[model samples]
Target: MNIVVVGGGLAGAHAVQELREQGYPGDITLLGEERHLPYERPPLSKGLLLGTEEVQSIFVHDQEWYADQQVDLRVGTSVTALDLDRGRVHVGDHPIAYDRLLLATGAEPRRLPILDALEVPVLCLRTLDDATALKSHLAGRVLIVGAGWIGLEVAAAARRAGADVTVLDTAALPLLAVLGVELAALFADLHREHGVDLRLETSVVEADGSTVTLSDGTRLNPDVVVAGIGATPRDTLAARAGLATGNGVLVDARLRTLDPHVYAAGDVANHDHPTLGRLRVEHWDNAIEQGKHAARAMLGDDQPYDRLPYFFTDQYDLGMEYVGHVGPDGYDEVVVRGDRERRILTAFWVRNDRVVAGMHLNDWDAMDSIRQVVGSPRSQAQETTARP
Candidate 1:
């Protein structure tokens, strides 16, 4: 059987690795739109942008590894059309037949229309080229629109590079979507402490030349403006091919699409998580796990992908690892323990007397203990005893 995988990101690379490790005797074709091999994106916003990480270290697999494994790695090529009836994917004029197809197409950064009229380079951090271009202009006055993960990380990196950084957000604090108000406030304090000019509940209204007009009529002349609002799943290709899609390509717990011959993983797949119900995660760990899960599922493994959601982030002196699944407004109670002033703390979101999610800040050792009580009691009484 010949297997074809779309995208060349971490998910696609991991999926192929899983297939080969499972001893599948199929001919694997990994098609990438870029010339570079599959690379981890987390480093793009963090280490890569900061000039601390080398470009060669970011790749998922070396080019020599692909050639040695006898995997057909097609770079700088894209699948224009896919015909499910004929089990064929068209790369421009060329058609490739596949017995099994995996859509690991990742998401793209949401772009703003205001950048088009601006003379100064408006940046977005998503790809390798984006990080490279952003780093070059880091010495200037950087105005960041959207105080989300990527935006905040960029601010930290730019500040480290001696750039005057100003962050604007529509929300009250950074990471408000995923973190609680208290934790979000902590992050806001973190940035403020680090000399970031953070303007909360603010947005860009107009951009003319080097000056960007804010909603509050505050005009600022910044050399570089970055739009790091968020990312939107690259599900258009799958949706155009008539696959079921919502926030992402809808898939079952086993990572199987509606069509038995097809599957999706990574950021593009809206998985029906066992605990979280239908959700699409855009983090690195989810991509790696789901990619392998989908690969195994394609090989007739009956195991379901039910691993707990987890992700990590790094900014300035703060490092965090969080686990579990809780919507923005889902939790009923929040309990924070340890020295919040020292930055060694753990915050637990409790719902129905059970811990739905927990975050460990600075104290990485608390992760294991935090996991034990995630699905169990997380009340003030329990939190009093289980303070990590």
Candidate 2:
């Protein structure tokens, strides 16, 4: 069987790798828009921006591995269209037929209109090339919009590099919608203590060159401006092809689209998770595991992909690991353990008196305990030693 995987990011790369490891002796073609081989993106904002990680360390596998595996790795290629009826995808005018196809197209950063209208370039951290460009401008003053994950990580990197960092957000606190005001307060305090000029309930009203006007009538001339607002899935190919799409390409629990021959993983797939309802995860762990899961599904595995959503981040001295799903207004109360003032704590999101999600900051050996608490009945979780 011939398999074609689009998007040369972490998901696509892993999907191809899994197929080969599963002993599928078939034709595999991996298409990537970027010129570089498939690479992990987490370091783009963390270690790469901090100048602690080498560029070569980010790649999934070397060119030799692809050649040895007999996988056709095509970089600097774009899938112009998906012809589901013909079981093929178009690269410009050329059509590549496939018995099975995977769309790990990932996502693109949401662009801001004010930044787009400016004469000077407003930076974003989505690709490796983006991180390379932003690293040079980390000195002097850096103004960042959005206090989400990307924005906060960038602020941490900039401050560590000796730049005066200012973060603006429309929400009352960073990650307010995801973590709620309770946990969001921790992040707000973390950044502020690190000397970040965090402006909440603020937005850019106008901009020209490097000068920006805020909603509160404050003007500042920053050396660099960045937008970490968030991202939207790149599901245009799937949508135009008549595949079901909502926030992303709609897929079943097994990561298979309506068409059995077509599948999607990573940030571009809005999976119908069994217990968590519908979720579109855009984290590094999801990309890796979902890709591998989709590969097994392609090989006729009947198991549903039901792993809990997991993500980790490092900012300044605090490192955190979060597991399970907790949407806005999803949980009733947050149970805290350890000392919040010491910055080492584990917090559990409880809904109906049951733990639905949990996270830990600077608590290294609590992941196994966290996984036990999340997705468990309160009585069952209480039996674990790591109870909140």
Query: How well is each residue in 1-388 modelled by candidate 1, as lDDT tens digits?
Result: 8999999999999999999899997799999998889999999989998888999999999988888777899988889998998999899889999999999999998988977789999889888988899989998799999998888899999989989999999997888878868789988999999999999998888988777899888999999889998899999999999999999999998998898999999999999888778889989999999989888998899888998889998999889999998964488877888778878888888888888888888887788888887887865325533234
Q: Against the true structure, candidate 1 has what lDDT?
A: 0.88
The alpha-carbon lDDT assigned to residue 187 of candidate 1 equals: 89
TM-score of each: 0.97, 0.97
Q: What is the C-alpha lDDT of each candidate?
A: 0.88, 0.91
What is the alpha-carbon RMSD of candidate 1 to the true structure? 1.6
Q: Which stretches of candidate 1 lie over 4 Å from their true place?
A: 379-388
Query: For model 1, what is the error of residue 304's alpha carbon versus the real structure, in angstroms, after optimal superposition?
Result: 1.3
Candidate 1's displacement at residue 52, Å, is: 1.3
Worst window of 10 by summed lDDT in candidate 1: 379-388
For candidate 2, write residues 223-286 as lDDT tens digits. 8889999999999999999999999999999999999999999999999999988989999999
TM-score of 1: 0.97
